[model samples]
Target: MYCVSCRNIHMFFPPFSHLTIVSLLFRCPWTVMANFKGHALPGSFFLIVGLWWSVKYPLKYFHRKGKSSQLTHYYQRLEITEAAIRTLFSVIGVLAEQFVPDGPHLHLSQESHWVKLMNWQHSTMYLFFAASGVADMLTYLSAHTPVGLDRLVMAVAVFNEGFLFYYHVHNRPPLDQHIHSLLLYAVFGGALSIALEVILRDNIVLELFRTSLAILQGTWFWQIGFVLFPPFGGPEWDQSDHNNIMFITMCFSWHYLAALCTVAISYSLVHCFLTRVKRHGEREIIGIQKLKSDHTYQTALLGGSDED
Candidate 1:
């Protein structure tokens, strides 16, 4: 409820500064490693295979079925979700911005005027999420069994992602939509925590390297859990194949790493576009709408009314 200005700048922080102290707890190195080892491999593979399946087939299916609007509508939903999350994090960023200038745990401010320049970056990111969600749905349908209780569960999960995408694409994307709103964020934030741990010290790479091995082990555990444990039925892997575990484990690790990198790179592109589009002409062009408006003016071409 209170606003303060310092040196020609105005900022807002939550009344409960004590609440934000929890973010400090995230600074611990071992905790980050635990998180990385938890999902680095399994989460990564599941995400990639999921994405690939989504892209390769469902897109065509949707297009053929004339459900492109469903796709667009889903993207719109994701946009709204992004807007909401952006506002929440923007508030948090405003509160934490003052702390970034001092050390290893840097902060990014959402309240800065320059931050508004990131709008296109945010919008494009929403588009990616919407697109990815559609792909996920397609993959879910194409890869998983389409008949049974397990099928229902996968459908629900895929639908949930689709719903989020719908919300995001409609609302004019805000910055935090994809990362903070989904479980995928947990996977990413965990991996990033590991990256930061490495950056914090000269000898940290070995620790990170070791963490990757642990991740591979954990990924195998996840595959076994999902495969052998339930209504979904055990994996079709032949019990007689001696190298199944080893082969699956390596492939899983590769896919997992690839998924993480893909999402990270996707976001990086979002940031890059944001940086380039920050200004009107010098590399960050913003006047296309103006040019569009001018073309609407009554001209010597084709008689006069706005009814072209």
Candidate 2:
């Protein structure tokens, strides 16, 4: 319940502060590499994809009567691009999970040393997403399945990610366990939403809800990086502190609220913007009562009068 001012004169104009943001991204310090940056890479991926769904779904839903919101060729291209990005990022995730010098004992019980099972778990999680992307790409073939194969594939991927993380936190710090558990809520929620999309087929409300969950996961990932591994090499969190654990839970609830608000605002803005411009061959759909009113403008052209 405290508000702290980040207000500073130098920061206002010159881009002050350690650029902890930039350092969090680019610096090569060991903690930044293994902890913050690792979390952030996928965080960026989810955030961008969420924004894509948030924007595209609304445009499609609010299309004008005379035309589709997006042309066939363009929409197909966008789908291809989305799948490609997902696959490429997932591949990168696998690499990052395994290739580090001290990571992922990629062999089976190699003389009972360097088991590093967690590393392999993460790599396998990344592979699931890569599979989801491949399934999405197959849509270009116009292959018909009884349901949305891409959606179901993505749902499986989300479920797999959650499944891994749920077990990944065993014997870890209280703070780490609590934060990651919060993340599972979004992960499983998104998984269920995607599954429902496969069943419901083009339900806009579910689409928007899925988008919100995605953004929540993305933001939560970044927040996790910051909470467990403070930027600019700031002091580490007291993992055992009860108050710290309590605050993290509250912070997560706020993040959920923020994610919902983000989608709501984005939807509202797109609606307002789309309403202003009339599409080609667009005709107004007005009520019959309004059409009978001589004071109405479109009615005058149709020769309707109050008495008529």
**How well is each residue in 1-308 modelled by candidate 2, as lDDT tens digits?**
12222443235535656554443333446635576766786788789888888888887777633377557677777887889888998898888877776566366357666555766786888899999998888876465743599899999999998999899788888999999999999999999999998989778999999999999889999999998777776887899999999999999999889988888888888887777654322444444455667456666756765557
Cα error, residue 15 of model 2, in Å, equals 48
Worst 10 residues of 1 by lDDT: 1-10
In model 1, where do residues sit more than 4 Å from their true spots?
1-222, 234-240, 281-308
Give candidates' CA RMSD values in order. 25.2, 12.3
Query: How do the residues 1-308 of candidate 1 rate in per-residue lDDT, one tens digit apiece?
Result: 11222321213333435434343333334433333332233344434433432232333333334444556655545434543443343333333322222212322244554332222232333343334444334433444623232223323433443344345433322222322233333234334433443344223233333233334333433543343222233333443354654555465657457544544454455445544554435432336766666676535344544466
**Which pairs of residues collide in model 2?**
none
C-alpha lDDT values of all predictions: 0.38, 0.80
lDDT of 2 at 271: 83
Model 1 score (lDDT): 0.38
